[model samples]
Target: MALTGAGMSTASGIPDYRGPTGSQRKGSPMRYEEFLHDPEGRRRYWARSYVGWWQIATARPNAAHAAVADLQRSGAVGAVVTQNVDGLHQAAGSERVLELHGTLARVVCLGCGAVVPRAQLDRRLRAANPGFAEAAEGVADQLRVNPDGDVDLPEDLVASFVVVLCPVCEVGTLKPDVVYFGEPVPKDRVERAYDLLELAPALLVLGSSLTVMSGYRFVRAAVRRGQPVAVVTDGATRADADGVLKVAAPVQELLPQLVSRLASEPADALSASR
Candidate 1:
């Protein structure tokens, strides 16, 4: 099985939370508690997200994502678990991807529990805040799109942005379906990932630093089970000392080559041929 993270989508124009050396590159992200309790925080979030969504929506899957799909088609990789909220894995033709953090493509109502496509919410936001996009464009150079599809905006801009209520409930707040930094992933999803790890012969980690426990736990579980673990990323990972075969390289450059080699011969035969 292959596990991926934000680094997998960085080549697609989405920035990763951490730098190549595992240091945080952006400012503090929104916390779950803050978003849920602070009305002003929600407004700020929606305003920033509204300006940043276009970059994520227009991003195309990179070579790394396509290589993963090719590996899956050849039966070289089974179960893909990704920590990225962007739907690039699916966009690249990967099937049945297990999104550890939900997706930015969807929005959910906190009150009515109604889920809707993000595109629908985007239209509503545009309608409610006319000329907002043009204003955001004025600071486009200063705006940096974060991994969670939000940008840092001036306070005046954020205050002026209007947040729309859920159409289904008429009063509930709308939130991106993705799990925030301070929130716990749903239990069912965690359990399912554990099961996938237990059944897999080995674990291939791509693009993740294993910095967060949410993705690191799986690496630890695989190690405990005596599963051979291999990591392909660009920098320092928490699991570097866990007896993993760590390859510090860019996934977008390496994955395609790996897939090409694997497709030409069986695993055992390839070593013999080499």
Candidate 2:
């Protein structure tokens, strides 16, 4: 089962990071280069992110997360692969899972490739930027999660935003564990998900538009193998054309139902396992 983009998490109270219909930095999600190379742009991102981080930190998993976990426990789903970094599935007790785009709970040092949990950075940010000392006054519909997994501020506050630097490394910059634009998803990761597909006869996609072919490529593979594809989302998705079961509704509502309907047998659960 694939938990997709923004539409998947709306019930969790997290805003969609992309689209005019969604929230956060507000255009088609910002380009990775802008966050890395541009100063003012970077500041805008960090400021919004700083405030946005609290939203993600305090956010809880909704029914979608619970249902998926239930599906796993019942041996109906082998693995729960996701593009979201919110860590909701694990929190809900899903054992075998894949973070396809990476996770926001962690930050990676560009220089040495060491990973650090974002909670540590949050503490540092509170000390470094006193505005966050109290509590993040939630921003309306911010991506909350960014390329660096560092901080996200609202658009209104972007102009006056300041960024917190990496405390552990002298010169290394921090980046979100998620795949950024222009970055390629590890081939092994994609192939590993395909491994799970080999065990199942279908790929059920929820909440994603499948615009990022990195995640959608598996859908294509599922089709090539004659695996059934089902999708649930309120918005138009890039993979709508490929769906055998398309439900124009929120995934939070449909996932639990779909999981309930799945026969209780996990013979083909998770990334193509032998």
Candidate 3:
């Protein structure tokens, strides 16, 4: 089994939250409670998201993503569980992927439970706020895209920004379908991830710090089961002590090399070892 995270997508122009070059973000992201109860916070989030969404929408899968697909096709990997919400694994033709966090491609209505494509919301936002995009771009000339598809905008701009309500139920608030900080992952999703880990003989971690409990718990579970864990990431990770093998390298260069070596090995040897 392969578990990936934000670093896997860094080469595709999206920034990770806690990587070496991270911390470009000015403040904390909108929390679940803040988003639920504070209209002002919601407005700030949507405004920054509206600008950041273009970068994510236009991003293409990089070599790391393609290598994972190649590995899966060669029968070296059976399942993928990712903490990323970018949808790059699916775009790279990996079918058996489980997104631990919900995707940014969707939005859900808080009141009516209606889910809609994010593109539709983008259209609505564009129509409602004419000239706002250009104005925002002018203010933040070098806006950086964060992992959750949010950017840092001036407070003056954020305060003046307009947030659109859900079209299905006008009274309901529309939020991107992603697990936010201080929010728990859905119970079913967590169970499914555990099921994936339980069935695998070894666990391979890619590009995650494993700092958060969500990803760390899986590593701890694998250790308790006596399953060997191999981690491929650039910096220190929470799983370093538990991992049997830890490779400090950029995934974009490492994954393709790993896939090539695996593919060249004898089928029986690869099956017996993995």
Q: Whose lDDT is greatest here?
A: 3
Q: Score candidate 3 by TM-score against the native.
A: 0.97
Candidate 2 runs further than 4 Å off = 1-3, 17-25, 132-161, 259-274
Top candidate by TM-score: 3
- Separately for all candidates shown, the number of backbone clashes (residues 3 or more apart, or on different chains) is 0, 22, 0
Cα lDDT tens digits for candidate 2, 57-126: 7778888888778777765566777887777778878877888878878878777777888888667766
TM-scores, all models, native as reference: 0.95, 0.81, 0.97
- TM value for model 1: 0.95
The reply for model 3, stretches above 4 Å from the true place, is none
Tell me how many residue pairs clash in candidate 3: 0
lDDT of 3 by residue, 1-274 (tens): 9999998999999988888646776778779999999989999999999999989988999999999999889877879999998899999999799999999999999899999999999999999888888999999769898899988899898887888998987989999999998899999999999999999988999989999999889999999999989999878899877745899999999999988888788999888886
Q: Better model by lDDT, 1 or 3? A: 3
Which lDDT tens digits does candidate 1 get at residues 1-274?
A: 8999989988887888775522433457889999999999999999999999988998899999999999888777888999999999999999969999999999999999999999999999999999998898896576668899988887898899999999998999999999998999999999999998888888999999899999999999999989989999998899999999999999999999988878777778744533
Cα RMSD for candidate 2? 4.6
Pitting candidate 1 against candidate 3, the one with the higher TM-score is 3
